[model samples]
Target: MIALVGLGLGYMTPTVVFDTFGIVSDTTGGAVPSAYVLALVVMALTATSYGKLVSVFPSAGSAYTYVREAMHPNLGFMVGWSSLLDYLLLPMVNALIVKLYVEQVFPTVPSWLVVVVYTVCTTTLVAITMRGTSRVNLVLLAAAITVMAVFVVIASYQLLQGEGAGTLVSTRAFAGPETTLPLVLTGATVVCFSFIGFDAVTMYAEEAKTPRTLPRAIMLTVLLGGGIFLVAAYVTQLRFPTNAPFGEFTDDPLPQIGHLVGGPLFQALLVGAAFVATVASGLASHASVARMLLVMGRNGALPGRGLRWINPRTHTPVVNIIIVGAVCLLAVDFSLELISACINFGALVAFTFVNASVIAHFAVRRRELRTAGEWVRNAIVPGVATLMTVLLWTQLHSDALIAGGVWAAIGLTYLLVYTRGLRRPMASLEE
Candidate 1:
């Protein structure tokens, strides 16, 4: 359970407070805390669905397993394929974040070069082995948490001393002058990136000591991570209520915020922490995605021909690791906002299906909704979760929908060709 919580929180890419803080801050029009608050509500609710599903399934497939068993297999495949956008591009997101920070230090360096170097380093490390990664990530997560607390204290001191927003606690921190429901929802969609790891706890269900422990860990992870994001965002928002001073750095504002509150030394410290986060998440996600693709390949869902190539000495699926790195290179051309929205599309798709699967499994399959207690647990909870997920989906950028749609469509075409009209059964996701 402890490891699961750490995994989930670390999976959130804790550096987001620095990486996309400015993007979400600008997107919400200074209502950064409110965006986080709204995102927390949505994720906290969705975590329930994840907890419940993990108890029943108790396996590593996550949303793919739940939806495939409860709903139709093809629909499950769609959810899994859409999820690739979330899993595969996460390493890219980390790379993009590293590029943004690296450019600040070496302004003359081409962005593409930074991404390529970062990707190559991460892929090489993971392709060889992942020993001691958990310990490294834990240390990194601790460092990030320490940095966050320092920033909050420093920013709070600045605010109390009449630096930015005057007062430390004000409504302005949550709602800016131009803040509206639509804008806040849009920001909420972006901040959902911070909560991406909560459902990941389900991946460890089988390893959990008890069925209930995994669900508990899932909720605990969401709540704990959300608490950290909210506290930091609140203080940061209070320190700089608007992006007016952000000018050109509105997309990646950590540098500006760090310099303002803690000067060059603190700025360097924060950047270092952000770099640590990128390395941890990048290596972890790279290793995980390579294995996921290998699973899909072995199941014949995706191309299996070359994915089976394990290096003789490393004993790793070197080809799949390289494929993962190649995908991360796309980060060179994608902006932080567009990449974030696109990933959110895939995550919301999986969230949508996970909630829907609960209804199908209990209310539809088992007819357990007859009793009031059963109705509330099996129907109302997941029903509201599905609705909230759809609400967030409605706010996703059009480009994200198109990108995710194109990916999903490609998966559908491949599945149709491979399955030959759903007459054959593919391998179970549990494998």
Candidate 2:
């Protein structure tokens, strides 16, 4: 979970978020950092609600069970659909990032080759996941932490040289620009995307050898991941204040930062380190997404019988793994920013529901007023975050929003078909 969060935050947060915000408002203005800080505050509030929910229901179906028990069956399915989209979109985003980097290092290589290589690498990781999620998670955790340590080391050295700590302390200067409220809100929405993957921890509840332990892990992952991103962003600005287009720096900022800290060897290490981080995150994503699909299948929301097929030798969800892999591969056809936006949309939708679920879950419990506290902590903050997310979605380029809307509409239609065409008949058979 920590590694996944780190990879998610480290790769997605500082760079992409900054670029999108800059492009939209055409501002390297004072609001970018403020927007990031706002996103953190909002995420902290919603994380508390999610932390509590995960504590209560440590099932593989994190939101699946939470929405069902807290709200209604239809709501749970809706959460499932949104989560599935997030999971499905993430690998594509990550793969596209890798492709961008590969192009930077070897500009001559065809982009399609990079996509194929990424798919192959991810598929091999999925095959390994067939053994056990624990094993895959362990490797991912190690890889993620190792890469993060390298970043910390590089950043630390730069700070010591009086180069990378100033930005964290000094705010940017802005004048003459019309700093509109809607623009700030829109930037905050984009910043929200950087913090999206922390919830990957919740998705592992079912397979988590011990469910009770997951809440802590999930919270720890968020706290740690968020810290890393905050530091990385601050340090990046201190070291490279130009706010360079992410497309230009797509190869690896760490290496450039590493060169500033040390030299060529250090830069190479950082690139290699980022690769490990990428793989760990990619593998964790594969495991979590496959399980969600498997759980949905088992519940008969999907064609349970076929979708639940596990590899006899490995005891893993083979069919679901392949299906997710294929979709991720298909997503590679789109640009990285598009994939990231879609994932952000899906995750924000899930976060909103989870937070609302917290309030609903706590409201009916008569035993303690603690439940009221949970309601405020879980529901209210996430509710605000949800609104911010919607604003961000609206602010997105129309074509991107249209694509996301179409994907969501299709999922809803699938749910309707499942209910009428699948579930009602299953109920009749039981009778």
lDDT scores in order: 0.82, 0.61
Show where candidate 1 strays beyond 4 Å: 206-212, 305-316, 422-431
Q: How much lDDT does candidate 2 score? A: 0.61
List the lowest-lDDT window of 10 residues for candidate 1: 422-431
Q: Model 2: per-residue lDDT, tens digit, 145-204? A: 565566666766665667633433555422114556666665566566667666766765
| lDDT of each residue in 1-431, candidate 1, tens digit only | 77777777777877686666788877888898898898898888888888888888886667877887788767777888898789888889999888888777679999988988898888888877744555676788888888888888888888999988988879998888888989999999999987887776676565577778888899999999999988888888888877777678888877777787898999998888878877877776776667667656665567767886677888777899999999999988878889889889999999999998989998999999888999998999899989989999999999999998899889888778777877765556644
**TM-score versus the correct structure, for each prediction:** 0.94, 0.81
Clashing pairs for model 2 are: 59-206, 60-206
What is candidate 2's CA lDDT for residue 364? 52
**Which number leads on TM-score?**
1
Model 1 clash pairs are: none
